[model samples]
Target: MSTADTTDNAVRELLLVMPRLVGRVKRLPLPEQLRSLDLAPRHLSMLSLLLLDGPLTVSQLAGMLGVAPTTVSLIVSDLSRKGVLVRREDDADRRRRIIDISPDSRPAIAQWLSPGARAWRHALAPLSPAQQRIFVDTLLRYEAAVSTPTRTAPRRG
Candidate 1:
């Protein structure tokens, strides 16, 4: 096959395998500390964001998660009810509420995501520094591509 054809085939294989790999990762049982929380990936994702970015407003989270403010509010409510999240008035704008992952949750959240982290580390351990850098670079580029919103053509009449 031509180089272009070979590259296309490689891309097709990656596209097919990525989701299955993620599904397998997602199927791993939650650590006991996080089990009772009944968290979904979306929940974990928001909490993870908070853990990474500190407190954020509902609108800010909605923007990050690509959902509506009301949707994020519902998510915040559920996490709050479970004691995994805390909502506080923004110091500069009392009218705005900022949602933060409870400090108490940091340990559990870290433990919950640890399995995947370990798996990735194990998989990368044998790679040379150059290979590791290329792998990370590719992933960063892929993330950027997926995060960018594409303009869609209007439906035909």
Candidate 2:
């Protein structure tokens, strides 16, 4: 195969792998929520994504959540009314609006998605310092590879 063909195959592989990986990882939280909690998995997730990716528009949130923009807008509006996310209009553009996470909501996000934060804390108690370092390095390498951009048609900046 030509170099372009090889790159295309690799890109296809990544596209195939991404949804599986995301599906596996994304389901972890929904079932873990306690019976009495007010926040559904989707609400926690929207908050978590906002925390991780920074503030975003409804369209952007829809892309990340794999939902329609109308769905995202409803969720954002609900969160905004509840004061978990604060809505603000762009001063420069006036037309663009954004939803920012409220300061009071930070603790809720930590409770929801603390990264591998809990597991790492537990591992630290049992593993030697060197073993901990090795595990962390391996995890970081996996993260870097997954985060790298995949082959795609070129876009003009």
Candidate 3:
């Protein structure tokens, strides 16, 4: 088979598998404390960042998330009210508030998110660093492509 055919086959396989992968991840059980919060994808992303990278300020989160600081602040405020997150004064910069998963919620969040992390680690472990970079870059490109708005051609009768 030509390289084009091989690439098309790989894309077809991914198209078939991606939905099942997302569905399985979505079906993973949430912790009892988190069940009532109605957490969205945005919340999951924020929580994942905090869980993996430790605490960060709202501006830092905004930068990492590619969103405005006000957006991150709103999420932080909602999660804070739900007892899922804590905001503390940054020692180095007294005016800035550092956001983190509350001690009470940390273990539950970790337990909920760890399986995916472990699975990614297992999948990437055998890859060379350069291979890993390429894989990540490809995924980022895919995300960007999907996120871009597409214009449709006008139809004629």
Candidate 4:
């Protein structure tokens, strides 16, 4: 087979298995620290986003999580009560509340996230720096694409 054929086949195989891989990870048990605090698996995503993007308002987080602002507020309240997150009034807008991860919880979040970092590091070790960046950027782009909502027309009842 030609190189293009081989690449196409590889892409097809990845498309078929990627969802199952994500499903398996989703089904995995939450880290003990999170479980102890009664946070759901979705909280990990919330925590990661807060860690990366810094503090965000309820509306911002709700948009990111694809949920209602009230839902994000509830999650933020839970995390705040458990000391995993802090809710503060936005400086620019007192009416808006910004949610951020607690400083004390950073160590636990880092520890929980380290395994994935290690795995990615190991996988990318053989790649040149430029190739590694490209690969990582491509993955991020793919994630962004999939997370975007489709603009389908409303269906009839």
RMSD of each: 6.0, 11.6, 1.5, 6.3
Candidate 1 vs candidate 4, TM-score winner: 1
After superposition, the stretches of candidate 2 with alpha carbons farther than 4 Å from their true spots are: 1-37, 115-157
The digit string of per-residue lDDT tens for model 1 on 23-51 reads 99778777676778778778977876786
Itemize residue pairs with steric clashes in candidate 2: none
Steric clashes per prediction:
0, 0, 0, 0
Can you tell me which runs of candidate 4 are displaced by over 4 Å?
Answer: 1-8, 15-32, 117-157
Global fold similarity of model 3 (TM-score): 0.94
Q: Can you write out model 3's per-residue Cα lDDT over 14-98, one digit (the tens) per residue?
A: 9999999999998999988789999999999999999889999999999999999999999999999999999999999999999
Show model 1 residue runs off by greater than 4 Å: 1-4, 114-157
49-98, model 2: which lDDT tens digit per residue? 78778888777788888899888888888777776788788676678777
Task: Give lDDT per model, in order.
Answer: 0.87, 0.74, 0.96, 0.83
Structural similarity to truth (TM-score) of each candidate: 0.67, 0.49, 0.94, 0.60
The residue-by-residue lDDT of candidate 4 on 46-73, one tens digit each, is 8878876888888998899899998888
Best by TM-score: 3
Evaluate candidate 1 by giving its C-alpha RMSD to the native, one decimal. Answer: 6.0
Cα TM-score of candidate 4: 0.60
The stretch of ten residues in a row with the least summed lDDT in candidate 3 is: 26-35
**Least accurate stretch of 10 residues (summed lDDT) in model 2?**
29-38
